[model samples]
Target: MDEVEIVVAHAERATLRVGDVFLKVDVDRARAEAEAEAMALVPVPTPRILWHRPPVLAVAALPGATLGRLGGPVTGSPTAWAAAGAAIRQLHDAPLPSRTGRAGRSVAEVVAELDRECAALVAEGILPADLVARNRRVAETALRPWTPAFTHGDLQIAHLFLDGDRVTGIIDWSEAGRGDPLYDLATFTLGHEEHLGDVLAGYGPGRDVDLDVIRAWWSLRSLVAIRWLATHGFDPHAPGCEVDVLRARM
Candidate 1:
């Protein structure tokens, strides 16, 4: 690549690509350290770490396109989707890392935050009150007790890379930790609900999972993310994005 490419950028952090190297610049050194640690522990494909200094971590680029972005069309096949799911399961099943509280948010904290966001979404006229309320109710199913696992707290499609039918990489370990497994699954298949079956198939049937809880997390995540995405210079209202995810519930 002749020109430097910005993978993603915001106030808190930014990721830039120079040729085959990816430079992740963060505001918090601790979070960057934790990301490197999590990637080292997880039993999955990850970019090779080049070096890390405070507020910046460098890694070699993985050779594959991402499965899909929030507002993008599906690029990976059903088999590739299944491979991504299988890779997620492997990561989740692995032993929880020693330094694993990057997010450290409790379920009660999540519920409280969701409630606050929902109220604001309606009161500020960001979204219809009925839409907010209906999804809020739908999001409740995920509030029940759950076993914490080694979860990629933000397992969206952008973090997942696929090559043919194989999961080439799972990147962005900043959010990996001991968290609700369903939350990760829900996040991975958030807007891409159509391929959920393929994911479930590869996630395996040995473990019992509640479909309602996954649906609940869908609402909960989309509700809480609207304001942040908007403020971060992202168009959450764009087609096939967060707003579309919320609208699907109604």
Candidate 2:
């Protein structure tokens, strides 16, 4: 039987795998365009763009499995994680994409959005009020200004693919843009905090990164993402899930 896997399905977009091709369906044309353009600009390995028509994008699958999955133990070795980090650094050092307007979100605007989302979560009783409030306070540190670098705005582990210690490719460029460098690092290590040192080591020396701000992003992202995940029919309360990630910050 031919295999077909639903990679992700959410309000914004859906990604499916059929045979060796991955198809992405996005509701926003601009975001899809940005992703196409960003993939072209990034220096790191990326999935080959097979074709694009309106809402659907087709790309050839890359070699190797994902670096890890959310709410699960990382199967990839430390070397693979380090390789992924180095790849991220390489992308960060690359020149920014020409049209990055879609990636620009001011800290103030993000905080405002976070506040609104947090309020919704509290009102809906989706999470404990104190847990949400505590993480909200912790998230405030990441609201400061930063010098923008080319960032994979969503650098979750699953987006990174590796073969042994070699990084084969990175998938999901929809959120790629000029943004905080630490945001990428933070997002990459969201739930997998223990492996951060390995990533930082591979990120190499002399790059100034604020660890506290990175931690702040971890808190902010998990808290803000819970409602969206639940709305998308994902279980945020699973063991080692987003909710547990927030609680770990307490």
Candidate 3:
């Protein structure tokens, strides 16, 4: 091929050729801001272009493999789930950067953000606008005594990398933040209960788990997930799916 046709996919904030000068993008600025507060995460195969003007990251190309080809239940493996949990624990315990500013706003602030997002979603006729109100009471009740820990913000199978039963890497630090650690767990467990069990087992009993809070997050998270799926032409119906199950529960 004389020239490669590259499609910059979802959640990619910035992209550049290996030798091309980088231009600042909002994603790059956010990554820079987060790097000061967090330990550098484990490296993955994605090509990272480091020496551009504003600095751009080019993800390492996937090697003739796709998630669809990986087959089933890699996520349900306890060893894999546990390994993922351990990686997150390491991230949570990493020292706060001196240059890092104050932590993200309170859970209340997160709730407010959710409220605003829900309104926007509804206004656009994207999702059931009342979803926020339906779960707001539970979310508020669940927030009491909420303990904050490092959160991967978005954690799931697609964001993880595995070799058989081992977790070789966790991809996509784009949404990493300091928040309720259980939120990550809830994110993991939403549809995959067995994997959730394995992750918890690996994390051990020392983790303070509040099932109620997880339930609340599951409901809220699923609502958000559904909206995203709608935006991207993905099926809402499938077995062993958390979003569908959670919506039913809601």
Candidate 4:
């Protein structure tokens, strides 16, 4: 009956610890789909189905620190970025059968939707609205004509787990879908551009990426972040190096 530490998972859902049981509550259908999709994609520490009647996923607790907490890639480091890119390529290259049954949205469509949301907020006199369209356009232009490959809808450092130079596993499959292979790459780049080239370079050549589409997603993500910060009364316009990159796009 007592609940343990609650870690953020997705909207309205938290991976809660109850005694020795790790229960992922909320949005059963989506969680189920993500779990299945993740199992098919990569070897990660995703939750497992514990009971179906009420829907529960039992996941092993990650013991090490997340890559983001471990000083990240140190900007221009080739090892971390290159390894990340390889992992993304491997993920994108995999077949996503789960997506076959779900309706998919293009990167542009997703960005446009986010733009509409931000515009609506502005109309309602909402301050600190996210305006990263310019940045989104840059990335989308690069990701256009995306390959018919699987995409990890939200591929960020927070969702990735690393052990030294190797990627131990990836988490959060709620946004997993089928689309251009470069979706993950674009996500990675938006957060780590200096090292993105390293990841891409290590992933190797010949695999075409839709940079435009990635930009669209990245733009949407920035807008989402802005809204999130604003809603939580956090700094919407933080003065950081990454802030400049994202702001320039807006």
Candidate 5:
């Protein structure tokens, strides 16, 4: 008999593991639809879809462990990280999907939201005002316009599965869409800046990537995500956590 294990449970979503199948239950049907659609469009390896019902999606478990966890040391080799980068490059180069719902934000909208979130962080006294302000300034570099590409909007390290030096699968496509390519790169390398060179090497040459903008996105993303994590009962202030990532920017 397959015993069910709760993988993650939060207000917005929950995931369960039963034997070889992983079940994702989302509060938002649109998000579930987008995830399914994105997974179908990406050229890279992804979990095989088993079935779907409204609000619930099931996929077969992929082989191997996650690439790494946030705020923790990455156990995967540099070769694996490079392979993940190449996979991302392939995804970005693929034809744009038509049903990219709510995929990206305008520069002005992003800046405005950043300001709002920064104020909340200050008011709540969750982070130092100076640190927030400095990072906010750094985030300005990412506000300029650029050519868009197919992006896994939330490409965190833990979402990638690896087997040896190869990328076995990428998961959690709820935020996939047509967006800034650097955002995906920045998200993947967040808190793991040491592996950026490996990723870039596999991402290949001739592609102009602005390091400053990537760093800025790192700052902006961490600052914006602090409250959400806290509200969801997750710690952002732990060692090497999002808060630490922001302070490290100094």
Candidate 6:
């Protein structure tokens, strides 16, 4: 029997690896079911669903290393990053999945969450008041209305799987839903600003990604996430991570 490796665990969800299979266990089975459905809906490659038995959704691990991770060296080349961007464009362009309890957070919902999280971060001294305030202002550009697209709600850098210059697959679709495409762009490139141009190049430059909105998302996401990360035994202050991203914006 293969030994089980704990991939990630938090209060709400956990992922375990046993050889080639990854088991994602979520408290809400609906989200797991949605992940499977979302994978089927997306145009890009996704992990093959081995089985989904309620709280646990098992999948065959895809080939290749993760594109990169926050606060770590990028293992992928420029071509690979561009390819990831193109994959994102393809995902965004795919037919809008019926909202049908799939996954989504309205702008109002997001604003409320951000506001609440920002207050806690400052109140708890997890982040400075001024830093939080500054980023709040920066985050405002993302609050307006946007034409909805099929968005990978949490497009972390580690989510994209690249084999050479080709995007082999993407993982984690529990957050898949219609949303502002810029949020996906912002999340994928978060903490890795230098790659934005390359990503946009592959995403198609003429499409016009407002730099300010992207910047706002960076600030908003960082500010909103700092407290949770700090609580969850992750460090937002690490080099090339969330805090650094916020400081750079100053």
User: Judged by lDDT, which candidate is best?
Assistant: 5
Model 6 RMSD, rounded to 1 decimal: 1.6
Predicted candidate 1 versus true structure: per-residue lDDT over 1-250, tens digit per residue: 3679998999999999999999999998888888999888889999999999888899999988887788888787788888888988898789877654523467779888998999899888999998899999999898787777898888898998877888888899998788788888899899999999999888986665788889898988999999999999999999998888888999
Off by over 4 Å in 5: 101-103
TM-score of each: 0.96, 0.95, 0.68, 0.73, 0.97, 0.95
Q: How many backbone clashes does candidate 6 have?
A: 0
lDDT of 6 by residue, 99-197 (tens): 532225677788898899989888887788888888898999988877778988899989999889898899999888887889899999998889998
lDDT of each: 0.87, 0.87, 0.53, 0.57, 0.88, 0.87
Clashes of each: 0, 0, 3, 13, 0, 0
lDDT per residue as tens, model 2, 115-196: 9989998999888899999999999999887877898888889999888899989988888888888889998998888999
Q: In candidate 3, how many Å is residue 11 off?
A: 8.7
The alpha-carbon RMSD values of the candidates against the true structure, listed in the order shown, are: 1.4, 1.5, 5.3, 4.4, 1.2, 1.6
Which regions of candidate 3 are displaced past 4 Å?
Answer: 1-28, 32-55, 59-76, 97-104, 118-133, 224-245
- Model 5: per-residue lDDT, tens digit, 104-159? 67887787889999999999887888999999998888888877789889999999
lDDT score for residue 225 of model 1:
93
Q: What range of 10 consecutive residues in model 1 has the weakest lDDT sum?
A: 98-107
Question: Sorted on TM-score, highest at the top, how do the candidates line up?
Answer: 5, 1, 6, 2, 4, 3
Worst 10 residues of 5 by lDDT: 97-106
lDDT of 1: 0.87
Taking the tens digit of each residue's C-alpha lDDT, what string does model 3 give over 182-243?
77777666666556666766676666787777777776665555566555545444555533
Model 6, runs deviating above 4 Å: 100-104, 205-208
- Model 6 is weakest, by summed lDDT over 10 consecutive residues, at 98-107
